[model samples]
Target: MVIVGILSIGFVVLAILLVLVRFVFDLRLTAIQQEADHSQLFRRKINHLRKIEQARHIRYLLIICLMIGIGLAILIGSFLVLMDKQQKLTAQNQIDHERIIYLEKQQKQLMANIPLKKYPEEGIGLEEYEWEKWSEEKKDVNLQRQIESAISKRSAQYFDSFDTKVSLSTPKTISLQLKGYTDDDASREMIKSNLDAFAKEAEKVSQLNNIHVRMITSVSKEKQVVYSVNYSRKKSEDKFNKQNVSEQNLKNSGEKG
Candidate 1:
């Protein structure tokens, strides 16, 4: 498209140059004819006039060709530009569609495994170990208790709003919700900055509790912000399975004995 546009401009310049040259040539011929009146000069003048006329016609033809070339270049350039833009838009839409599908699948999985009061219309979602509640009868009882304590301490230090909810469960999942405003640019920046600070602060406590943190943020059309944090740790699959295998072997040996 850029090349075509440049070529179009070049043709226009060429046409202008041809017109100026023809004008000068015409003036020169008129002056020479006015100055020459001798018989020999009159014959030469007539022949020269015929040659000038032919040259003028050729110049006119060249200018017309240049004009047509310029018009075609412009038309082709515009078509190419529109086609390129359309292709880019189509690719972007496809990428966005794929991303949406992936996120929806993840959201469904989290909703199935975890209990939640509600889901946002649009936002990032992630899954991690649950650390909100501590259960005495559950495995890893000590770790669960420590995680709950850490979560409570961090929540109290960072957030005191009534809207904030810090809950711990048996598997040790910490669920936190923070309400924020985003009515303007300053408010939006404030929301973003506070969320970052809160996440980092919570994550610091999470590391001490030996758990992972997943932070999800959503914004509504009204510019309200919702930052949700899920903190949890996954039980070691290999160790648990090995322990079950060992217990079964011991039981079989006792029966044989």
Candidate 2:
């Protein structure tokens, strides 16, 4: 666009210069005619007037051409920009499609690795065991789904029994902490039983162990219960720490394995 604008301006300047040169030539002709006595001063003035009219016509034509050139330049530039944007959009869409396909393939592979339990429905199975057979990918998905389901179910059950509101935070490490009020020991025990059952069901489906249930209460006003479960994989540091302690004990007793 800028280049076209520059070219258009240059052409306009050239046209103006040409008109000026032609006017100067007409003046020279008038002078020659006057000196040669071939034409009177009035005739030379008339000729000069004719040249002015022609110059005006040329100037108008030049202005029209300049406007048309500028309009074309702007239009062409806009079209080029639009085409470039469309190409970028097309490329981005292709990239997104490929990424989606790759993720779907990854999901299928992970699901294949897990041991799926057959249900009455064909092509549909329940994840029955503690997701130990699942790959890291499948396990993560299963774990998140399980945790969310448990939280939703437990939260509803807790709220139903007590008029006091109960809110559940996001479950992390298979632990849920609840806060509310209970009528009596029976009510508290009921809530505890409900939470314990939920934890057991989760344990059956996921690789977790040693589920712990803890509750805190301020008399009848509020009560909070926390459920914690350990993932199946033990941390390397914990194992190493245990081994080191055992080795130290064995050395003190002068025994070796």
Candidate 3:
């Protein structure tokens, strides 16, 4: 840019000098023509000489005009380019500002569509936490279906075949029930252990006001309920977290309810 400015200045200076030279040359030629002998042919010759000089100077003036035009063109072109780049920068800044506003307004919208609950093993736990949060703020918004499905799906992995159902009476309390046919007494213990695992895992991830796990089993193929009992909340919730008082207690009350 400095080079361009220097060249433009040089061109303008040269043009001014050329104009001054033409002015002085015209005056000298005019004086010579007047001082010449007043003969017709000689005066005609002087007039002819004057025409040639004028034409030559006009050509030099055109050359000077060309040089001046080139310099002005470069300066104008540079200004236009600078203005274009500034417009582009302004447009980019506007886009960046809009993105910042969107991020600030909707934080939860990020990664909201990922099937975290179905694909990942810990997805249900995440939903449980979300439920604890969203349940208090909005009405008719809960993740109960996913929670129930997760519990039922996990039951087979931990214990013998048992159909599972879960009910959320409120945001803070939930009930789990498992029913299956089993004659071996060991099967009941396995079911209880698995129930404790499920509840504990849930508690680790979410909040619950009351927790109770129930199981029903029968020895015969008729599927009549022979063992039906409800275990109370964890001792951590009631000064006692034991799932059962003992195996003896489970058996003693197993047939009664």
Judging by lDDT against the true structure, name the best candidate: 3
After superposition, the stretches of candidate 2 with alpha carbons farther than 4 Å from their true spots are 1-51, 118-257
User: Judged by lDDT against the true structure, how good is candidate 2?
Assistant: 0.46
Models 1 onward score TM values of: 0.39, 0.30, 0.38
Ranking of candidates on TM-score, top first: 1, 3, 2
lDDT of 3 by residue, 1-257 (tens): 68877887788889889888989989987897788467888888889988998899879989899988987887887778888998999999999999986763343233222111212234334234355553464534356666656666655434443456767656566666655555566656666655555555555544454555555554453434433333334433442144443222233334432
Clash count per candidate: 13, 0, 2
Q: Supply candidate 3's per-residue lDDT for 66.
A: 93
What digit string (tens of lDDT, one per residue) describes model 2 on residues 71-149? 5676677678879999999999999999987875565445334332221222112244234433244356655566446
- Candidate 1, residue 248: the lDDT equals 14
Give each model's whole-structure lDDT.
0.46, 0.46, 0.59
Off by more than 4 A, model 1? 36-40, 43-47, 50-52, 63-67, 74-78, 81-88, 94-113, 116-257
Q: Write the per-residue lDDT of candidate 1 for residues 32-106, one digit (tens) a residue.
A: 666645587687866688687877768697776869687677977788889999999999999999999787656
**Superior candidate under lDDT, 2 versus 3:** 3
Which pairs of residues collide in candidate 2?
A: none
lDDT of 2 at 81: 83
